[model samples]
Target: MDIPRSFTIRESTHRIHNPLDDAKLAVLGRALRPAPGWSVLDLACGSGEMLCTWARDHGTTGTGVDLSATFLASARARAAELGVADRVEFVHADASGHVADEPVDVAACVGATWIGDGVPGTVELLRRSLRPGGLLLIGHPFWRLDPPDQAAVEGSHATGRDDFLPLPDLLAQFGALGCDVVEMVLADQDSWDRYVAAQWLNTRRWLDENPEDELAPVLRAELTDAPVRYARYQREYLGWGVFALMDR
Candidate 1:
């Protein structure tokens, strides 16, 4: 029903759980150009930043479903802070296989495609909640360059070389799935640094506040190795983006 305590602690301060910063997120929203009162369904919507911000800026209303109770609380607070509490709703539930009661103008699974097992399955899941001609947004990472070996793949936090395709192949995936690639906003190196580096700081701060906690050792190890691993592998070899798709 909820994420692990250690996971929450490590990303406690993150507003948008992925590499997209505020500016890039806003750019994606603008590219989509959802009309006022358009409905959106966001699965694994960490902190509900996308839904809340879209509700504020685009006058859309949406529902965000996530398994993390802690993140849902933060999402609700963010909605209220943005004066969009009445427009967006956050549900504390598993996002996997969850479909909206009504078809929505935009259906999204950002940065958590595992909810549907992988990119293909996740697209199927999102399609179930999308109206005809509606948009589907998927946030995912692609290999910026081919990893030299298995160790390089692992260093980029991937289990195997097949975990991600290169950028062109990833775009082709949508076409293979019967969707047209309409738009995309990619994360730059600076955004990647912000996302990964902030996690280290959050872990460090939590460790400082809870030195005796059982998870302290785990966080310590992560903080120690994360930066070097990110700088050496992911920062240069991994790229992330949110792509807009529509049924052709």
Candidate 2:
């Protein structure tokens, strides 16, 4: 099956697929309080940064699943680099309808809840793989402030087409999915800068290679114009975070 080409390309770069920073990731790892024997199933686990870090810091064991072969390779390489290769496995597979091969202490879908439709469906799907009282860490976007207009809205990278909710509604959606919010770690503007600005670097490189390519124009313009608008909209008016959940 074909995955989103942008996502696969983003994975090949080793930066986060979303606007997250080391501080935010540290918060996520600490929020879970992973233990030596604890196992975490990181669904749609991008480059496996969280898994590798958790294993190194907490001795946690886990598997990370993603559709991108490129991402899985990076995750494996990172696991080895962190000396956690034995503790984590990176699997290349579609995670939309997946379950853990074995029950885990944590089941997470960070920045990719769309794998199961949205927060509700994703939490339900992940819950099946979680042990009773186990933790589930889901990363998603929220509004820092209400958008001023459709232009402001588009600048934040949200589409009129998707079913994104505000933070309050997102939290409520989690509750509706049969989970209680136990903890959360939000990404500040600096974190957003890391995510959005890095894309400029990526897009610039892509443009340099495919100068005459049609899509390059739109992407190049997005790269040039996005930073200012993104900082104004997403960084100033929208926030994103990872939340810890449990079966209620």
Candidate 3:
């Protein structure tokens, strides 16, 4: 199985699918402090950036699983490019129920918690592959400010107000799941701009090159409205971060 073509088309140029830039991603790898030879499992590992980069920088080994064949190909190439092909592997598989064959030092489900239904379920899923006291990394979005109404929620790309919790409540969720929040790196408005604004350019470029393609209209519409929607709604209301948690 594979992700929708439209989804990949929109993010074809993204190395890291979330709001994290390269510097912030490096900061996260350092904060986690995974020793050389430590093992990691990254579920829904888009483009395999986290695994490949950590394999390069920290000398860690890992497996990345995703449903997107296109992304998996990019991930594999990234591993080779970083000279970590021997240390990391990318599998084109559904991450929802894919646990590591053996316990790992770090288990992560970044920015795709829906694979396990929601935060609690996703944490539980990650824990299944984590060694005792091992770290679990969850990337998620929280409400930066409470939305004014339903329209604001939709504008932020959420179906409803309940789709996401406030930042404090999100941290509390880790506690509720019996995990201690150990470290976190948040994305500011600039990071959000980098992530969302770049998609518009990618879409626009693709639309220009493939104007006759059936998806061109969709891309054109998205390019036309995404920037304003992101600037007005998502940038103001949504904050995203990757949180490191340890079992309590």
Candidate 4:
């Protein structure tokens, strides 16, 4: 019913929960330029940043679904902080099978497509809640560079080489799925550093404060190795982006 404790702890301070930063997220909002009063549905909406921010920026209304109570609290707080509380709502639930009671102008599953298994299935799920001509925003990683070996693949946190497709292949996949790739915002090395390094800091700070906690040892090991692993493998091989698609 909720995310793992480790993941919750690692991204405790994250607003977006992906490699995207505020500026990039703004760029995405600008790119989409959703009409005023549009309705958005975000699945696995961590902290509800996208919905809250877009509601503020575009005068849109939104609903966010997530499993993490901690994140939902943050999301609600963010909505209040942004003065969009009335425009956005957050529900604590599994997003995998969630379908909006009313069709939405935008349906998104950012960085959590595992909810519906993978890209294709996630798209199908999102489409179920999308109005005709509405946008579908899918955030996922692609292989920026082919891994040379299993060590590199594992370092990138992918179980195998085929876990991600090359960027071109990924775009082609959307076409094959009968969708048009209309717009995208990609994360660069700097954003990746921001996302990954923040987790290290969070883990380290938690370990320092809770040295006696049972999870300390596990996080301690992760913090010790994450920097090297990210620098060597993930930074070079993985490229993540949120792609806006429309059925063709």
Better of 2 and 3 by lDDT: 3
| Model 4 CA RMSD to the hidden true structure, in angstroms | 0.6
By lDDT: ranked, best first: 4, 1, 3, 2
By the TM-score metric, which is better: model 2 or model 3?
3
Candidate 3 error regions (>4 Å): none
- Alpha-carbon RMSD of each model: 0.7, 2.1, 0.7, 0.6
Cα lDDT tens digits for candidate 3, 1-248: 99889889889999999998888999999998999999999999999999999999999999999999999999999998999999999888999999899999999998999999999999999999999989999999999999998877998989999999999999998998998999999999888888888788888888889999999987788788887888788999989999999999
- Residue-level lDDT of model 1, residues 1-248, one tens digit each, is 79899889978999999999999999998888999999999999999999999999999999999999999999999999999999999999999999999999999999999999999999999999999999999999999999998878999999999999999999999899999999999999999889888898898989999999998888898888888888889998999999999999
Q: Pick the candidate with the highest lDDT.
A: 4
Clashing pairs in 1: none
- Model 1 misplacement above 4 A: none
Clashes of each: 0, 3, 0, 0
lDDT tens string, model 4, 1-248? 78899998899899989999999999999999999999999999999999999999999999999999999999999999999999999999999899999999999999998998999999999999999999999999999999999999999889998889999999999999999999999999999999999998888888889999999989998888999999999999999999999999
Give the whole-model CA lDDT for all candidates, comma-separated.
0.94, 0.81, 0.93, 0.95
lDDT of 2 by residue, 19-127 (tens): 7787678777776688798999988888899989889999999999988777777888889989999999988889988898788999999899789887778888998
Candidate 2 wrongly placed segments (more than 4 Å): 8-12, 210-215
Misplaced by over 4 Å in model 4 are: none
- For model 4, name the residue pairs that clash: none
